[model samples]
Target: MTMTKKHLDSARRTLELEILALQEQLGQLDHQFDQACDLLLGLTGRVIVTGMGKSGHIGNKIAATLASTGTPAFFMHPGEASHGDLGMVTRQDAVLALSNSGETQEVTSLLPLLKRLGIPIISITGAPYSTLAREATLHLNASISREACPLNLAPTSSTTATLALGDALAIALLEARGFGPDDFALSHPGGSLGRRLLLRVADIMHQDQQVPRVLPQASLREALLEITRTGLGFTCVTNEQNQLLGVFTDGDLRRVLDLSLDLHQTRVDQVMTPEGKRVYPEQLAAEAVHVMEENKISALPVVNQQQQLVGALNMHDLLKAGVI
Candidate 1:
């Protein structure tokens, strides 16, 4: 199909106008924005965001973002509030009202009750001089000079500005609450992120009797037996103190096979790699994964700082932990 220059020009024009409008709306990040953040952060109960029409949709998304990022928040539709949904907001909570014209009757009607209850009200509107903004303890000016639409009817640029303001509010709350990646993982614990943050080396490592192990003086055949029994590809050789001495792996077995050595007569010390790389028990399973990958090894013997053999973890454990 042949592309026309007229259609491309129209698309580019719309994008440029919206971008400029959004940048113009950045002036809303003033003291009023600070006051709104403070009000929401100081709330004893969840933040209650209320709005009408398209503003309501943006309010819902903002509420969800705040809720997931460690701030407690929820959206309350103004149209529903007129029909008794106002019960969602309480004296302990703070209300963030959104109305482009500041005259959304359904939203404005709740201000009197909110005021009487001493519930702080913050407003997001295009008109800072509007009734809703004037009545609010904090007013965020999400005003745009013109709509991207030619007839000045449709809400294209205005809605985008409102949504960006919502993002700013959510991120401010997230930062002020000290919400970090691990906190985020806690909220989203069923996915890959949860596995990475929550799963530890101890959680996935081979324990006690399951760990492949043999004494330093044990025959290579004995080490092979331990590896075969545990099926973990490696055997740890420890001293009388249960301290790590060396390690013999499947790779060592292949090398010994190349030499045609007598497995029963060959001592493990002769075939083993002494003082092999090891990890601590409390180390992050992800870090263990990095060590294994960097060295091209499949397993690592976990030991204490004093070098006692405590645990063994393999690539399979990391794979299960989603760190691989």
Candidate 2:
């Protein structure tokens, strides 16, 4: 086979082996899994994860996932823990240890100290009877038939199984604790998901003089000037009291142009879309995206509870705010 073909075969074989390892893990789940979840749920403190080498990397990711999903957790490097980092763990915290063979020196060495603190130990290991597993308060089996590595010397299927099991534990805990999207958004406020969940129309809309609006009795030429000045592509037609009456957009101008009406003489109210699709200031920016999408419009007039025009927004505004 060509070198490229040989590489593809190796990759495929590796993936197949890892997939089988995950499938094997599905059968290993027992009441111990439920017990582990119960222990974590009852904890008034954080979940402290620790491991060495490949296991350490997986432990870090698992810790992050657990913390972000509502269960507070952090990764503690086993080697560092033996020095002075052990001070970070308190009796209120539980230890989630990872060791493929369940006997890594760095991880196993901390078991006694953790035990002395009366901390609960949850271990994920390939060997169910290994030192770490046996000493653990609760053990999770992450065993695989063999490594996906051709020589069976490198960590492959084993690491994949351990990571998958960690994810399973986190999601199970997330559901049991009744964690929802809003709670998740609070933890991830800097991300796009948080923006979609937390940002309101009032937060991003152009308001005050920045809002493109004109009186209904104003000439279409005057409304066009407002739209051009504000650069929002649309202008709201409002009454003297600032209540929204209608909206005139680029699309409406195109249609009006087809009739060759005089822009300076025609009233904006006569040509505007009467009581067009609108959004409220307090509505979610994501909801504004939905309304604009459903109505096939690019801009919307923001209204208050009394139907007063308060702000204006367009798809471009949502795009800039990362709501798109």
lDDT of 1 at 37: 83
For residues 140-257, could you state the per-residue lDDT of candidate 1 as single tens digits? 9989988888787788788889889988888988899899877987887787767777767777888899888888889988999999999889999998998999899999999999
- Per residue, candidate 2 scores C-alpha lDDT tens digits across 221-257 of 8988998999988999999899999999999999999
Rate residue 113 of model 2 by lDDT. 86
lDDT of 2 at 172: 99
Question: What's each prediction's TM-score?
Answer: 0.81, 0.92
Q: Tell me the lDDT of candidate 2.
A: 0.95
The candidate that wins on TM-score is 2
